[model samples]
Target: MRAHYRGWEEGDGPLLAAVTVLGRTGPQVHFDGIPLIGRPVTAVETDITRHVTDNNLGLRFASRGDLGLYGLGVWVRSARVGDTSVSEARIGAEEWEEE
Candidate 1:
């Protein structure tokens, strides 16, 4: 998984992001990025095996700043069962705003 933060300003606070797979003892990874000072960050867990039961994937983001007008992009790549190649297909995307 990869995450990118864009349009960061000078006063914006650093953002904390984490990814977790349900039933797992710990998160896949947790990272922080400061606006105007951070680059794209990637997290990988190669030991995770495909589960036969239902599993939940979680994403969490937090910051002390108001987070005004910033762009966040997250990409998750995985290979299909029995497929050796990974697909770059995007599942969905949307824009949001707060009043």
Candidate 2:
């Protein structure tokens, strides 16, 4: 699967993968080492970015045999400490005064 992006917001992005058939059998999606053939297809891999946030996203996956696959997992984005933009933050006290 592969994709390309050009600053579009939501509902836009090339197909990461689309295998209608694989090696003489119907293509399938796998989750956590299990085959998700008859499960309800619900999750998707999303890429999220908004001002000062440039990163990839990986979230929520499930399988059909899951009895209580009732929760989600993620390679979480850490609690962002502060804005990382250096150019936007002034260096001098006067920069913060008389504004």
Candidate 3:
């Protein structure tokens, strides 16, 4: 699966990116490896500026059986590291696949 960020905060900060499927307890998949069932997902921390729409954040997986359609939810959290801090977040999702 793949995700794109069309709009983003104007400046740099610690960034958190995650995706979840409806009805699931955690993130949809892992960002660094082939995904399998029952593995826990973690938020990826990175530079927010790299998340533009052209730089697709994606995941790959191996499913043993037929997979049905499901909704995808994307979340982004940004936090400025300082004594007086600022934080921002956004969430979006859609019915994302067909089989």
lDDT of every predicted structure (CA atoms): 0.25, 0.23, 0.30
lDDT of 2 at 87: 10
Candidate 2 per-residue C-alpha lDDT over 1-99 given as tens digits, one digit per residue, 9 for 90 to 100: 112222444787543221221211324434354343322222111111121133233222223111212122211111122442111011112111111
Ranking of predictions according to TM-score: 1, 3, 2
Best by TM-score: 1
| Residue lDDT tens for model 3, 2-48 | 22334356686433343323222324333224232222222232322
> Ten-residue segment with the worst summed lDDT in candidate 3?
60-69
Tens-digit lDDT string for candidate 1 (1-99)? 333333456798544342212212212322222111111212121111111011333332324211121233332333333424232211112232111
Question: Which residue runs does candidate 1 get wrong by more than 4 Å?
Answer: 13-84, 88-99
Measured with C-alpha atoms, the lDDT of residue 21 in candidate 3 is 32
- The lDDT, on a scale of 0 to 1, for candidate 2 is 0.23
Clashes by residue pair, model 3: none
Candidate 2 lands at a TM-score of 0.18
Winner on TM-score between 1 and 3 is 1
